[model samples]
Target: TSTGKESVNATLPVGLAMVRAIRAYFEETGYLIGFKPAGGISTAKASLDWLVLMKEELGRPWLEPELFRFGASSLLTDIERQLEHHLTGHYSANHRHAMA
Candidate 1:
């Protein structure tokens, strides 16, 4: 319940609450549920923080793709750009990885 600001800070509380709920559910039932931090996750830093939070709160098992996923088109752009820079020592133009 925010003012629709698409910043990471704005999303943090929501993410935290959702993660806590999932963690509690798992602890109470022993049934792991998938979590998707969808939309508005448009930056690599945001995605990284999300992974770290998931690991910290839900443990390393949440790092698996089947357990966590980002549901944004722009996130793919950021990820591809980061991957290219990591693998090739160069960052591609943002437009090059524009979400289709």
Candidate 2:
């Protein structure tokens, strides 16, 4: 499950249910569960998906960005584009260099 809008639009309920099921299975079998929702997460909502999963399933918040990494380089591109758009009222090709 991802926090990205695409994932949310495509199958949010399924993602949430899958997380729940994984949690239940882990609890029943005494297994340590690890879930990584990586890629296509450029929006704040997308980021929140991981937090929601952690809180709902694990009963805690892991707020550290190191633990919850946005896996796609393209996501950074999207963020840069949006920021540039906000600041300049247009997208700039040079914004990519700033990220680097």
Candidate 3:
């Protein structure tokens, strides 16, 4: 977890680097580790950045939901807004995409 207060943009690199080190140390064991960066990520750009970083540092498999997840609901709302803007050419109100 990312302390739920720090940006994933700032923490993801450090986290991925640590994962790489662990993978390097356990290369012979074939250990598969999942990364769940929870909290402090609230922008569509941040979500996309996470995808890119995960793909670059952890390979394509890590992009799977089973391996990677966003921990912030607000982040999802922003993503939905971006998608709506792309598809409809207008951003919807944030309340339209409510999270439970």
Q: Native-vs-model 3 lDDT? A: 0.76
lDDT of 3 by residue, 6-91 (tens): 53434676767866765675576777777777776789888888788878877888889887788877787888888999999999
- 2 or 3: which has the higher lDDT? 3
RMSD values for the candidates in order, in angstroms, are 3.4, 5.4, 2.6
**Candidate 2 lDDT, 26-93, residue by residue in tens:** 77997755555654555555656667766766665334553334554455666676678899999768
Clash-forming residue pairs, model 3:
none
Instruction: Please give, for residues 5-97, the per-residue lDDT of candidate 1 as tens digits.
Output: 455533667788888999999999999988877667778888888888889989989889899877766778888988999999999998786
List TM-score per model, in order. 0.78, 0.51, 0.80
> What's the lDDT of the predicted structure labeled candidate 1?
0.80
lDDT of 2 at 35: 52
Say which candidate scores most in lDDT. Answer: 1
lDDT of 3 at 63: 88
State the TM-score for model 2.
Answer: 0.51
The best-first sequence of candidates by TM-score reads 3, 1, 2
